[model samples]
Target: MEWEAPALVLSATPYGEGSAIVHVLTGEYGLYHGLARGGSSRRGRPVWQTGNLVRARWSARLSEQLGGMTAETVHASGARLLDHPLPLAMLASLCALADGSLPEREPHPAIFQGLTSLLARISLDPQWAVDAAMPEIVRWELLLLSELGFGLDLGQCALGGGQDDLAWVSPRTGRAVSDARAGEWRARLLPLPAFVLHPEQTGTPGDWYDGLCLSGHFLRRDAFGQRHRPLPEARIRLADRIARLADVVPPDEATGENSPQPD
Candidate 1:
């Protein structure tokens, strides 16, 4: 079988001496692993880096086999992000997360679009790259959680039947809670940062940080499992670098009480 599609290079691992096994997120095919004939060489190296956009053709004897890909560069966005450390780390984390979590060869059209959108956004707004990416990444995780059948109810309090003024999410049930309803159980709940519950209301570095904590906690605990697979170091480093630029607390604090205050 043979097919061609728009693909974003998520990862490339050396296969033998000169060849590489390329993992791409395709609009139609989702995450696919294909062998690139000479992907390790200078000419192919640029095209195979994570975040490179390419038009790829794949062929194999059977549809299920590890196919061969002939890729042509459509854009080289990844190389541009290298100059900025924080954006680069964010990019690295994104690639790592997608590579680890996404099901192979299954189409995730929404995620593919979101990834492309993020790449484009980061390329243009280097100063706000991390800030810009946090929400979308959280959204993507929420989508992934939903697709995995562990969707959280973020709209309102799951138990109180009232709007979640200060949502304290239940880690066990993946639901939002109001402060009133969480009276006795307050200590048991995770603070739902306003940026996530209401991004428009919270508009600071801290808000973005809160969104990450909220989403990351659920993703690791519920989606990934308690083995405590830390987020790629690059991600944390990037968030730190960006926080410095914004004159804010560390990335962890950015997600806390001081996220961009609502205008």
Candidate 2:
């Protein structure tokens, strides 16, 4: 079987002497792994770097075999962000999360499109850093969890069905909990930021962190937990960086002059 698709480089690891095993996320093919000859060589190195966009063609004798791929670079995102640590880290975290979490060969057009949008935003201004990058990243994480079948119901309170005064999220059911209903159990519930339920609203750094924590809980318990793997270090680093920045940037200003335009 043979197929071709536009793909984003998620990871590439040396396979043997000159070949490498590459994992790419495609609009139609989801996440795929293929062997690439000369992928580790200097001439082919840039084509396989994480976050680069590529036109990939894969061929195999049988339908179920691990195929061989030939790719040509379309956009060199990794190279462009090399000097920008925060955006670069965000890109790396996105790639790693997609590689580790998504199922192979299943189409996820929304997630793929969201990733490209986030990368384009980062590429437009590498210096935007954590302040500019974290909001989109947090939204993307929530989208990913939804695509992976653990979507949080944040529209209204899970128990009361009331939309106003929603305050906490049930870690067990992945649903919103209104403050009135969360009286005693609030201590056990995760904080539900207003922006999460109403994406149109601007959110503070604290809101962003709360959103991440709310999503991280399910990502760990539902996604990675089932796989018995921890969340990637790159993701953890991004979260820590955002948390630290939240301490410095006042809540009101975080979504104002400091934040990047919403993705």
Candidate 3:
């Protein structure tokens, strides 16, 4: 059995002399692990990077076997992100989360398209790649949660049934709460990022920081925690890095106001 598709290289672990255990995400095939011959060599290394978009072909004697993968670089986006710290972190966390969380061999077309869109935007931006990808990564996590059956109900307030002025997300229920309804509980609820409420605008670095905190909570609790795993270290580092960049509280920090938000 064999298939060819546009794939996002999620990971490449050097396995033997010149081969790698490669994992890629595709719209049609979902996440697939394949053995890539010569993947670690100079000529091939650039093509298997974590965030590169590639045209990949995989074949095996049976549908269930680990296949041989050969890919041609369609966009060498991962290498370009290396020069920018935040974009690089975003790229790395994205690869790590998708690779670690998504179920193997189950088609998630929307997730694949969202990833392709973000990769295209950041890679094509010669100057503003960080700006281009910032909002998308946070939003992508929400999509990931939704696709995985943990979607946040941010359309209306869980407390008031109101559609406007949504202020906080109930970390307990993954639903939105308006400020008026939140009242005394405001301090406990997660901040519902303005950019998430309004996708037409670009968020300040600070708003983007809130966005990460909001999504990271449910991702850790529902996505990773349910599987008896913690959120990926790459994701933890991404939050910490973005916190410092935006000058905000890191999501997982222990503080006096509340207990440390544990996964």
Candidate 4:
């Protein structure tokens, strides 16, 4: 089997000598791993870096076999964001989440679009990018969960309190829970940020942290847990970054405790 298409470089792990096991995401071809000769060499290193937009071609003798791949850089996102730590970190987290969660060889076009959209936003001026991209990255994860068949129902309270003022999410069911319905069970539920329920509004740093904590819970439980894997380190780091910005302790990846900000 063989194909050539526009691809996003999700990750490139160094293999024997100069070769790399390159993983890429395409709108039509979910996630794909292939062998790229010289991928780690000095001259070839940048092409396979995470978050790059590339024109890639892959070929193999069979549909399931590891293929030989080659790529040409279309946009050097990794290099472009080298001096911008926040955006670079966001890109890394985004790439890592997609790499870890997506099923290979299946198309997830919406997730692909979400990724590219977030990448585009990450290229803006540093502070603007950080502010804007934080919510976007959270939303992107929400999109990923949906694509992975674990979509959160943020429409109305799981307790049937209706959609108004939906303020918490049940970690187990991935459903919204209004403050009134939360009752004594509130502390056990994840926060459902107002901005997440109303995307037109801007999320304060606190809300972004809540959004990450909310989405990360399901991503860990449903997407990675079923496969017996933990959430990606890059994702944890992203949450940590957002927590620091929000003046809050990062949520524990295992416990999903939404730690309150310092008083």
Model 2 / residue 228 / CA error / Å: 1.8
- Listed in order, each prediction's TM-score against the native is 0.84, 0.89, 0.93, 0.94
- Model 3 residue 37 CA deviation in Å: 1.3
Residues 1-263 of candidate 2: C-alpha lDDT, one tens digit per residue: 99999999999999899899999999988888999999999888999999988999999998788899999998889898887887888898889889999999999999999998788778767866444566677788889999998888888888889898999978777788889999878777878877766667657877777766776777766677688877777777666666775674322112211221111
TM-score, predicted candidate 3 vs. hidden true structure: 0.93
Indicate the residue-level lDDT of 166 in model 1: 57
Candidate 3 residues lying further than 4 Å off, grouped into runs, are 253-263
Q: What is the lDDT of residue 173 in candidate 1?
A: 72
**Highest TM-score against the true fold, candidate:** 4
Task: Write the candidate numbers in order of decreasing lDDT.
Answer: 3, 4, 2, 1
For model 3, residues 1-263, the per-residue Cα lDDT tens digits are 99999999999999899999999999999999999999998887999988999999999999989999999999998887677777777778888889988999999999999988887777667356566466778889999999999999999999889998898988788889998899888878888877887877778878878888888888887787788777888888888877787887775521111323424
Winner by lDDT between candidate 3 and candidate 1: 3
Better by TM-score, candidate 3 or 2: 3
The model with the greater TM-score, 1 or 4, is 4
> lDDT per residue, candidate 1, 27-127, as tens digits?
89888889998999878899898888899999999999999988998888778887887677777867776776678988888778878888867767877
Model 1's alpha-carbon lDDT is 0.72
Residue 241 lDDT in model 2? 60
lDDT of each: 0.72, 0.80, 0.84, 0.84
Ranking by TM-score: 4, 3, 2, 1
